[model samples]
Target: MINADARWLRQARSRLRDADPVLARLIDDRPDFDPRAWMAQLPPMDLFGALLFQVAGQQLSVPATRRTLARIEELFDGRLPSAAELLNVEAGQLRAAGLSWRKVGTLRELAERIADGRIDPDGLSRLPDDEVIAELTAIPGIGPWTVQGALLIALRREDVVLPGDLALRKAVKAAYQLDHLPAEPEVLAIAEKWRPYRSLATSYLFSAAIEFSAAIEPAGAPTDAPLRERSTMAATRAGKGRPR
Candidate 1:
């Protein structure tokens, strides 16, 4: 759990509410919002496992990602595997667990780095966001989006945002009433106003996007409707590594 200062939390809320009326309304509508609450329900993951989950989830729906992860955990006695444990597992077994060839290679590479001390989860935690990104992205298949997810879910950084995320762009458009989805640069510029709390702000935006999606999903659509039917919801929910 993150040790948040009470004063910082209060200040972030005040500043965010003051900076944007839309977000202010969101804050008002959801009084019980705790951005970090989603983390409570996730299976505990170390930094490597968090990165693995992020990679596993990319471009996939929340439920699909969970299914894949469940299969993976089943391979390791119903627990998220450590780097060493992952290394011990055969590539074929991981492939059987629904991991793509690319994802499997990425995981193996990540395991190797962790095992060799080239990528230290503990050390990465202490570095600035840019350094963390640079170091992690050095590994294959670890892109900016993956690192951003890690920054939020694993390191619990305060100011980071995932401008590269399509869901976030859609959320900005819907929540801010933009005619078109904001581009990456536009998202970054808008996020600047929510400085020092982008992570928290993102959480609220994601929640708002999710509520908006649920309100709009077809009345009789299957509860297990594929994620494509609700792209925004999947993306927003997946960004936090959780189901809506």
Candidate 2:
């Protein structure tokens, strides 16, 4: 099994350069919006913590999610809970931590899978993007968007596009000034040109999308506002509680 610590990002970055022209320009543009630089500043994170982030962030506002995760930490030993520790927490207590029952179940399942080697976080860093997505999505409650987000954030896979993310679709629509949300087909059509560095372009689009979404908000709103609030509510209202 490949250890995550054995992964080398520089090699991957070189491999991703020509993933596509649109992506290539976004990545190769020297001194032009280096997204990886921001990633570099983030302290090295563990695979388990990354998985917890995925569960906690699912279908919730970022601030709200963080608050909930903090509550979960309080529920634990004042630190991030381990998979074994979480399994011992009751379902009722789990709900009290602000996670839906569905998420609780999903998280528990993920832990079980990891413990049993049905899924391997340490190994995913070495698999190709498509293989990683396939393996992860095979687990119940895991989907394309969740897997895609994990790939970018945890494994730092650079070429995948999440056509199903509403935030991404909304961002693409606003960036291109589309009349409505771009359908998956249209989104894929645009993403096709960004073969290798699609991940970087996707991040830029997500940031730009947040800016666009908040452009029409009330001017008096506090800076504490979170973009995920709208994205989550809209999805929940539309019955999209599947963790985008």
Candidate 3:
């Protein structure tokens, strides 16, 4: 399995390199980059836990998200709660952990669906990417972006790209020397060359953005307001829960 994965990655890398010169340089520059290395630092989470992470991150900075996640974990003994366990707790408890009422409601609804066999977390991996997105997005507050993050972090799907991600847009701007931040459709059009390796290509762009941010910012200086807004979400998707 490991060999097969390696072979597959090599093929993907070659294909991506041939399809776009920009991505070729990005891939060449980081020959040893492990796209999923950041996952090691996080606690083991199932599909529900992954969704919880994604949902918790919506519209919150990295530090705030981490704090919220920590508070939620403290309620359940320092780990994210399972779908059943989450449903067992009161919604007030989740709110107290810094989750908004909307997030709390979304999570509860998701947990209830899973608990009642309306959605099978385990079966999700067997379905195609679009199917998973469609199934999850049917629940309120669970949009394509949230499901896309789950696809990368939980399912490890190979071809996913988050065109709507602000950090990714910024990354694309910097990497491609665009005059302005590209919209979702523009990002998708640029990413067309990435094809089956969009996920891998995304990892490279995220790494570049993080590196560029660090290079430009001085120590102890506040991040630019716009970039700081979604940096945590991008970083979390990049790897560990911290900034990318």
Candidate 4:
């Protein structure tokens, strides 16, 4: 299997630049951009930490996730708590750390499983993507989107795509000039051309969406909106959760 390391990024960039001209322009627009920069800002995480991060981030805006994670860190000396630490904390404490009760249950159960060897992180890293999805999603409140995030951020899989992510769907629509946000199946179809480099394509599309939003915004507009609010206000105002 191809490792999604620095060398993989170079290859992915070359392939992605060749596969789509519009995306190529987007990449060219930001010559020094690094897709992993955002991930770098996050606290270093193992499979367990990555899974918790994904769970914590579900349906929440990025800023909200950051705040929640920050609170969580404060509870554990500015680090993501290990499974034992998580299990030691009260559920109410976790809820106060910004997780919903549903998420609290999910996280606690996940911790329990991991702590007791019901799920093995090292073994999981060895599983195929489908098996990994199956294993993680068996726990309630954990779903495909969460698994997709872990696959990309934690496992560093080369060709992962998060079609269910609202931001991604929006990015795809805006990038491809589609009339509406592409459904998951359509997103998959469009992404077929980006195979083995879909993760890189996703990064470019996200960047393109940001640039498009900025370019089209009326000059002197308020710039204080948080990214998730700015990018997905319509969905949020409509009371929908931002997809993970």
Candidate 5:
């Protein structure tokens, strides 16, 4: 994973502080927050692995996603498969590992394209964000939200946001004190002020939402589920990758 330079992070924080009051308070309240801390729990992922993560996470909860990923890793001796390796595996193998038929097909198609040189994972990193989105979104089952999550997790793009994320929409409503949950467009409109540091801003809002959810949940209720859900929402929806 990429690490933002200390100076760069400071600058991003300062910019967000001036850009919006809610984020300003959020940033101030957590003086030593590490926005990327959640990633530590995830396995090391290449572009293909990240895409697999996004695909497996579709419409599933965080616990379910992790379980599926664990089974997939078990198939490869405890590691995410390379594109070639994935293509070598039968579709039924992935299905047995808990992936939906649609996800299995999507992953196989993506792996084939990458393995055959139709899609260049290395080259994608060098392209502008929009160009990368354009190229990847052309694939079946891969949408803007999926590509956006890959941009953040795989490429570490700084300015990306997931307006389509349901948890994020709820977080925006809570953070901004909106009476109703904001739609994708409204989320985008409000996030306009967070340009250039949106990923970081998004992390803050996600953290806040998770905390609030945990606080209100019954004492015996499962806590890690919600935490993981919110933490990975940038990559995945309500409990799945952003509801597409």
Candidate 6:
């Protein structure tokens, strides 16, 4: 299993302190930034389940997707099913377990590939970023956005960002008060300044999105917030990729 208590956080922040002049001033402005406490609150999870979660969550709203995931646990008698067990289940049962027919097909294809050794889910933990993307994208319905997200949540890899994610791009545009949502390459170019601590930066951007959305809501609106059209949890206990 990968170590969740990666020391990258401390090192990255230190580098940022010395490397970026403005960040150095910002750190001085708020001397008590606590990276450890922030990280400690993020739940730990295995890479494989995260990948499954990512695939399962694509294009689903957060609450609806969670209900479906809970359905999967219920399907396997209150636990996440093993890969082999997943293969043995009837496709209809999986659909009943709460996936759409398309998602059911996507999951089965992924499982079959892994089980047959055409793709190695376990091997993902050890692969580099580009290799992980290359390997994972070989599966049906898996794409760069999916892989970029898995890399962040599952591996807890630093500096990886899903530039194509609409939520994140929108978050950045709103947070930074940019004139327009940046394109993918522009997103990458901007995120480069956040290197090594980009994961932490991502956390802030997501927080900023929630903050911005709240700021725009009617003052007397209900606390539950308006239902999102197709918003998946950006951060997952494991995979849970950004919903397109």
Candidate No. with top TM-score: 3
Q: After superposition, how far is residue 192 of candidate 4 from its true place, in Å?
A: 1.0
- TM-score result, candidate 2: 0.70
TM-score per candidate, in order? Answer: 0.86, 0.70, 0.88, 0.82, 0.87, 0.76
- Candidate 3 contains a number of clashing pairs equal to 1
Model 1, residue 241: distance off in Å is 9.5
lDDT of 4 by residue, 108-147 (tens): 9999999999999889999988899999989987877777
Q: Scored by Cα lDDT, where does model 6 land?
A: 0.60
TM-score for candidate 1, please give it: 0.86
Best by lDDT: 3
Clashing residue pairs for model 3: 235-244
RMSD (CA, Å), each prediction: 5.4, 8.3, 4.2, 7.3, 6.0, 6.7
> Cα deviation of 71 in candidate 3 (Å)?
1.1
Candidate 6 segments whose C-alpha is farther than 4 A from its true place: 1-7, 17-44, 214-231, 235-244
Model 4 CA deviation exceeding 4 Å by range: 1-7, 214-244
CA-lDDT, candidates in order: 0.74, 0.60, 0.79, 0.71, 0.76, 0.60
What stretches of model 2 exceed 4 Å from their correct place? 1-34, 37-44, 214-244
For candidate 4, the TM-score is 0.82
- What is the C-alpha lDDT profile of model 3 across 1-244, one tens digit per residue? 5698788888998999999999999999988887777777566778898889888877776777788888999999889999999999899999999989999999999999999999998898899999999999999888888888789878988899887777778789889988887887898999988998899898888888776663122121112222332435456545645431
Ranking by TM-score: 3, 5, 1, 4, 6, 2
